[model samples]
Target: MHKSIMIQGTMSNVGKSLLTAGLCRVFKQDGYKVAPFKSQNMALNSYITEEGLEMGRAQVMQAEACGIKPSVYMNPILLKPTTDVGSQVIVNGEVIGNMKAVEYFRYKKTLIPDIMKAYEKLTDEYDIVVLEGAGSPAEINLKQEDIVNMGLARMTKSPVLLVGDIDRGGVFAQLAGTLMLLTEEEKAIVKATVINKFRGDKEILKPGLTMLEDICSKPVAGVIPYVYLDIDDEDSLSERFVRRKEGGLVQIAVIRLPRISNFTDFNALESIEEVNLSYVTSPAQLQEADMVIIPGTKSTMSDLLWMRQNGLEAAIKKLADKGKIVMGICGGYQMLGDTLTDPYGVEASGSLAGMGLLPMDTVFEKEKVRTQVTGQVTSPVGHFKLLEGAAIEGYEIHMGTSSSKSGGISSFSRLEYGLAGKREVKQDGYIMDNILGTYVHGIFDSEEFLEGMVKTLLKSKGLNYEQVKTVDVKAHKEEQYDRLADTIRQNLDIEFIYKILEAGV
Candidate 1:
């Protein structure tokens, strides 16, 4: 039988994802077949599996760390928030329906069977499964209906390690208060407590650790130091949004949509030293940016309307008209078109005018397109001219189709499904003189794609750019997994974790 352990957090963004990933790596390094599992994930950042299914990106990252292929079983329930209190609920990698927060809380109980099915499949295939919890288990109001935290641990009979973020302050209270809030039965599943994102001398933290353990009645598993590993963040709380704009050779600004999804597409460009990426939210921040990009959004029409209301749409149009390079991906690609029609009212009812930068029209459909893709660039001009003929591979996840109205303008890329499939889509996105848009989300992930983009973006700024060092994103990720494992192994009691797994709750 497969052994299991789960990482639960005191609150959101408490490093449960990273810790789970680290443990996965450690288990893999110790010569055990491992996989990552999360009963329910609520995040905008998602990934498309090889089988054309969708799952949370965090579990995908953890799967990478474990050196295993990601499956929908890793994240059976994905909630992509569309509005303040409503989200599109996806089960087994397909959309079920949109539900309000309260509705999901009441309806999620019905999904416990689906969760167990996925969990059982993973356990049967792997020697160990490292599960991750969503949000805090201390939320007394959400405890009863929860399928993600203590509930999942109970279901799997898996021991839990609670993580508290020291960087956020009140590490002790965060840890102790969580234990105090949980029921006695819930507390029994907690194996240990980990302090994440610590930045101080260990000696100075000794006394606090003692008091924390005393208050929580749990051993301190580890004090993980602050790490700056380049990994994809799962949601809007990503630290990348608050980074200071650097004066690199190329200045790229991505409009921070209210409902942005999969901003990790730009991770490769951000990794380049000569490229400075800033998440701009307003017209003022776009003033000095050489390239303005509108990223994918959960609610394209609503975000587009938001841009129009806040003068961002006008600013982008003005820049595009002035010969500045402007680009869009997925929903942003849809918004760049001349018109957006939603006869099915997927995002909203009726049709709306787009920014009119690209000569295309988008029609939102009821069904969503989710697939991994590969292709070569056919028509790349303006800032992307160097990328022409360069090989590109990525995934597509969108509910709208963008068709070119101008027959003269060619496609941005010629694509085929990355995995074997019978459905052959001839074209993707629309291309023009200085405006390019695509539904491909991870186009920049490959080495060739990044090389062309970085060199061109830098050369446009009058700087001679060269690839003095080649970076393979896949290789870099492997190195990061090892680094993360080394860090965690040095701090955490891995032997204790082994014991917890052996003695399942």
Candidate 2:
């Protein structure tokens, strides 16, 4: 018999994704075949599966914790926001169309069938399905048509462990108020309340915990202490974008665009002991960097314009002219080109001049390319000759096609395999002068490519690459999952959680 439990947060960024992932690890460690499920996810950080399908990175992370291959069924619906009030809606890993906030809200309920189809697949295959909720079920306005929170819990018949952020304060109010807002039936689905990110002595907070339990009429599952784990965060709320990490041999400044998507691509670099990776939105931050990276974005044209208006484009161009290493990935790669033309209004209508750092020009098309590819560096290039012949593996998810204007630029990688078993060998990206650009999202995730790039960067600075310790990101992530499982086992009521899972709503 398959059992399930849901983790719903009192608010966004209240550690919902991590908690779900931790639980997945715990269940997997306990010898249960587990998988994560989120009926809907609204985040720009997405991943492409081996089947050439897209899903939220949070689900991908949780799937990793479960030691399972990520599937689109894990996240049936993904909303990639393109504007303040609009988003590109992806259903079952394919883009349906862009929808405004009101339009999506009205049309969301209609996708319930799709959500259930995905959920049933997981239930049939796994012993335990760890479901995650988006935001809070307390949003009374959205509760009526809600398909992600209480509604999803009811649909899947999964008991919930509602989590509150104690570190953010108002742990009592957050937990109690959320319970207060839920209908009696909805409240019944909540098996227990979890106080997440708790610091200070639990003994000192025992009285308050008792009071919270008394008021909410629910068990305090646990007070999870704030853990410092190097996990991939879901969205912009990531502390990685703001936290300062001191002391490193190399400094890489990533241009933080307004709609930065898949910034998690750089987490591998952060794992290296000698590398200091920082997200920079200003010109001042770029001054002392050994390398600058332009990451993927949901709005390429608009973000490029934002950089142009904010002087970041000028600063990066100035750095490039001085022979400094500059790199671009996906949308960032498109921005590095000479021009960006949007004929179908995929991003925005009309053509916009790019950063003019590369000889390529990108034109937005109606079709989005989503595929997994493996390749190797092409011709050896100046400064980064160390990257020559390095193996690379990643995925491409973009709505544009880029080509060299003069056809004089050298190719970066010779990629093999495309969407749906299409056996095609094609050159991807470019390597020219001091610039590098690629549509591959996880370009640095390949340890071979990553180590080679790091060595090249250190070599350019006259530093010994052999002296520095590089990270095996894949192995490191497994260690982190174990660490997270240990932490959860120590703090959370795992026995009770298992009972809750078995008890089914």
Candidate 3:
């Protein structure tokens, strides 16, 4: 059996995921086979693994940091919130059904066997398994049957490193209060405490750190600085969702849907120097943007109705009519069609009249489409006309099928892969004038495609579109992993962490 150490947060977004990833990198760099495990994850942002299995993207990032391929076993249970109270529950990369918060909480303990099975697989394959706990483990009411956090730590005989966010203020209270609230046995597993996302002088914090250590009976392992990393984020709480625009030649505004998913699709575009990308919900924000994007969402019809009720649908239509670039992906692509028919009530009952930007109709199916694909833009339209025959590599994870209905519209791309070995020459996406829509996620991840988009948008503004540098998105992500590992190894007590693993609890 392999040794394991788990990181539990004082609260959500306290850098648990990043720290877990950092440690995974550090362990891997030190020549130990490392893997990350999250017993349960709730996030809108998800990923399809190489085997076509679904998992949380955070584990996927951690897997990359460990120099391993992402596996569904890394994230055993994924709960994607479709409504305020209910979530679509996925187990072992397959959806079981939807469940309310109370329903899931009551039913979760039954899955301890599944969680243990996944955990055992990781322990058998790797020398170190870096486990991450969801939210705070100190929710006193819900800690009874907790399969994550203290419960998981005890099961794996793993020592815990509790992390608290200093940037959120009340860091000492957050750490001490949580430790104090835990049952005596639960508190005993916490080998160390970490103050994350700190800025300014470490000396100023030394006094309080000592007092916290005394109160909690745990050593302050580290005070981690607030560092900007270009890694993939987990959910809507991400800092990227904040609305802010840097002045640039090409302005792009993404419609911030209420139930946005896979918004990381635009991360590559944000890395470009000349592109100013901001997420907007109001109609007024669309006017200043050179290109407006309708991103993927969990509830297509509901979000489309929301856009219509809020006048954003009309605003998008007006912009497209004025020859401004309007593009959509997945559920956003479904919204751009003439109609959206959900016979089985997958999204909602009956059919919804779309924005009519594209002459296509979408029908939701019970079967979800999940696959990584490699293709090329066989043809192009509007601002991206220069990208004809450009090779593209991305993925498709959706439930709706869109088919064009008119002569004026043309296919955006042709797929040579990801059709399950049939060698499909399938045409994806629809193009009509300045309006474009596709179901491919990470389309802009390509250097060829992104550079072409920037140059075209800049030229359309009559600005000199020269001297922009090419960017490799993948290379940047790798560098970020190294940086994160370096930061954590420098600040955190890695020697003690190694000792904790070596002792095997």
lDDT of each: 0.89, 0.92, 0.88
Candidate 1 per-residue lDDT over residues 1-505, each given as its tens digit: 8999999999999999999999999999999999999999999999999889999999999999999888999999999998999999999999999999989888999999999999999999999999999899999988888899998899999999999999999989899999999999999999899999999799999998898888878999889999989887888999999887465667899999999999999887777777789998899988887788899999999999999999999999888888778889999999998899999979887999999888788889999989998888888876778888888888999998877775523587888974575757568777777788888998889778778877766666767776524479999899999999999999999898999989999
TM-score result, candidate 2: 0.98
TM-scores for every candidate against the unseen true structure: 0.97, 0.98, 0.97
Q: What's the candidate order when arranged by decreasing lDDT?
A: 2, 1, 3
Candidate 2's residue-wise lDDT over 202-287, tens digit each? 99999998999999999999989999999999999999998777888889999999999999999999988778999999999999
Name model 1 segments beyond 4 Å from true: 245-247, 407-409, 418-425, 466-470
Error of 3 at 221 (Å): 0.5
Which candidate order results from sorting by TM-score in descending order? Answer: 2, 1, 3
Candidate 1 backbone collisions, by pair: none
Q: What is the C-alpha RMSD of each candidate to the true structure, in Å?
A: 1.5, 1.1, 1.6
lDDT of 3 by residue, 8-59 (tens): 9999999999999999999999999999999999998888876777899899
Identify the leading candidate in terms of lDDT.
Answer: 2
